[model samples]
Target: MPIDMSVWQGRSDPEDGNKGLRWHQKVQPADNANESGIMLLGFACDEGVSRNKGRTGAYDAPVAIRRALANLAWHHEAPVYDGGNISCDDSNLELAQYRLAEDVSRALRQRHKVIVFGGGHEVAWGSFQGIGNYLVQKQHVAGNANEAQQPPRVGIINFDAHFDLRNPPGGKQSEKGSSGTPFHQAARFCELHNWPFKYVCLGLARTSNTQALYEKADRLGVLYKDDHELVHHKMEQTLTELQRFIDQCDYLYLTIDLDVFPASVAPGVSAPAARGVPFDIVEMLLEPILKARTPKGEPKILVADLAEYNPRFDIDNQTARLAARLAWTIARAIR
Candidate 1:
């Protein structure tokens, strides 16, 4: 779980003036508590994918993503820090997720905008837990000054081809969680705490998910748009709905599963989309969420992550580059 210092290395040019600045030049270790800015964390795990009977190479995605991001042009004014990787070793996927949650909570408490690079969609579980823990801690610190204050309403916006709400092959007690069960787990967590599960899914493929999953989504009151509905003509409506979702929540957690893009655009995921939404459309949808702020001027996005990039299946590092580009966009757009 230590930071791989070598992954951040890239070409440096001192003579090019401001044009020479790149992520490698700006990114520092997230070891200093006083410096608050963007914190990048990697979830080095593929056990979830393996358990779900998908490809197994996603565990190496963190390093791949960092290598792709290292040379990208830097435009953000805030400091960037690498918090290293939370690795799932020895097939102990649960333990790794717990560790990731701990790190994420710590980073948020320190007031850093977090971007988690994933091993699989399973990363969502850890990220969700971390945000939840941070909110609880913040509420506790606020004390009973306002007993009437309601808990923060967290809305999750997931861009994926699949619903990813499947239970393990067996029941929960008989099997551990997998890449396809994170959102379901999140819903259960919210239910246990008596909190609302406000989830919005985009780019769903009717062929990728089963009827049972659709039923589950409806029961959970999940709002979603199919791949067919995300076209250029309908984008305005989509953005309007997205804004409504944002308006209802005090915090937002955005997670992008690379498989949501066409196979040609993101061929390295565990499950590539047969017919996916275009990257430009996805970016268009993301812009408003990235820029959204509370009436108090506080940023609504508390934490975000990109999941399920399997480098082993990548073509000419296409998926890696796209993930890095999305990360870059997030860093620049977040206030």
Candidate 2:
């Protein structure tokens, strides 16, 4: 895949030198052989969102979000890589998803930290597939190590407005999965592989999710906190729950759906939150977790992603800017 240089833009001032260089000037196309820095992979498909009966503009989000991120000043020494995108058409969702998994797997194999920008929440399925495959491969290579020497567990933390636990139509992949069903797919994948799925969902909206969804989440043993509880009150308690969950896992994958923020700050999503958690609060919750090391002295966070930003409905690019800032936060926070 070729890098789309067209998405990157910023002024280069010789007088100011390195101080004036933005992310666009600093980021390069990925060199898989180079075992260093962060790589950005874009999933440019909204067929999943459309199939889930949501808006159609999310397919164009990767470029729009990149345009927002490109002009931001580069403050970290970690080099950034634009690994290009995995695009999908209406007739080929499965192929695109498979290619994304392959690309993600390739990156992980080379020990590069990955930041995936999504076409929709469905991006999680591909992202999880890649990470799982890589870890499973590692286990096989270990070749019957003692239980204490086994590979660490993988945990997922998602910040979103809805549970996204809807059952796939006809109850299988042949029915075609959607943005609203990625986590469901992920949970099933975990079960099939016997991988410990320590999944935690934050910033859920009680009004947005149906009773059936809640029941499904309960049956799956998913841990979740609603928006009201986290944003309006019990903030400390929420953090405690999050900490407890994080403490039990060795490797973590963080996914943020922009809709988890208030509509005023992020209106360009398929489902905007009426009263969502503030960005600052989210930063508060993430900073320590991202910076922390596991009990085994390994970095807790392995890969992260930002999902569900639709450029078509944005106002003054507010949503895109938020996405960029969050990406910047992740880059700086990762150890």
Candidate 3:
């Protein structure tokens, strides 16, 4: 589970110096916890996918994403570090999530912006927990001794084809959660802690989600825009709503499930979208969120992740390259 140093290799052109630099030449292992910058963590687990009866090859996504990103042009000035992968051993998905949470919390504590590469959409649970833990610690350190005090609101914005709100199989409490249950679990977590569950989902396919899930989302007061509503003609209205959502939150957690894109663009996902949103539109929506800042001048996005990338079905590494491009975009937006 250590940082796979081999994947971080690519072309080199010393003659051009900085102009020719790429991520492979710039990214270093985050060996020092005190180093504050951007950190990339990998969730090398597909057990959740298996449980959800989806494709299983997403477990290898981190390495594939890194390889794809390695040769991309480095366009940012911030120090980038590879925090390594957290592998799921056997069927213990819960344990793997706990480990991921620990690493994510540690990176955040060190003031490193985290961008996790996922094994599945299930990575959301661990990533959410880590962000929640960090917020709790931060609040405690700030002398907010009263637990009853309103905690900072953290908004979750997900770009995905499915709602991922299914409960554990058979409604059994002892059953392990799957890739389709992360948001449901997150909602429960928010309720347990008495925090507002501010979630907005974009690019959801109407045919992909069931009526029960829609009802669940309504009950949870989730804000969403379907795929049909994100067209060029409706973009202005969509972005206006998105901006209003952003304005209400103190922080943001952005998660992109590659399956939200058309199968032609992201065929290597657990569930390929038949009529997905175009990459240009996704990028357009992402631009405002990435550039958004709080009233105090700090970036509103605390953490972000890319999920559901399965390389086994990829054609010409198309999906990896796209994921890499998104990662590059996120990296460049970091301030």
Could you give candidate 2's per-residue lDDT for residues 1-335 as a string of tens digits? 56877889876776888887788888888854355778899999888888888887888899998999998988887778889989887547777878888888888787777899988898888898888887877777775664455545778889999888888986855437888887887778787777766788888999989999999888877889887777636778878878888888878889999999999989999888899988877887786678768777756887898889999899999999999999998887773
Backbone clash tally for model 2? 0
Per-residue lDDT of 20-69 in model 3, one digit per residue for the tens?
99999989988854557899999988999999999889999999999999
Compared with the true structure, what per-residue lDDT tens digits does model 1 show for residues 157-208?
9999999888766774333789999988888778777789999999999998
TM-score of each: 0.96, 0.94, 0.96
| lDDT score, candidate 1, position 44 | 90
Q: What TM-score quantifies how close candidate 2 is to the native fold? A: 0.94
Worst 10 residues of 2 by lDDT: 143-152
Question: Looking at model 1, which ten-residue stretch has the lowest summed lDDT?
Answer: 167-176
In candidate 1, which residue ranges exceed 4 Å CA deviation?
Answer: 170-175
Backbone clash count for every predicted candidate, in the order shown: 0, 0, 0
lDDT of 1 at 116: 97
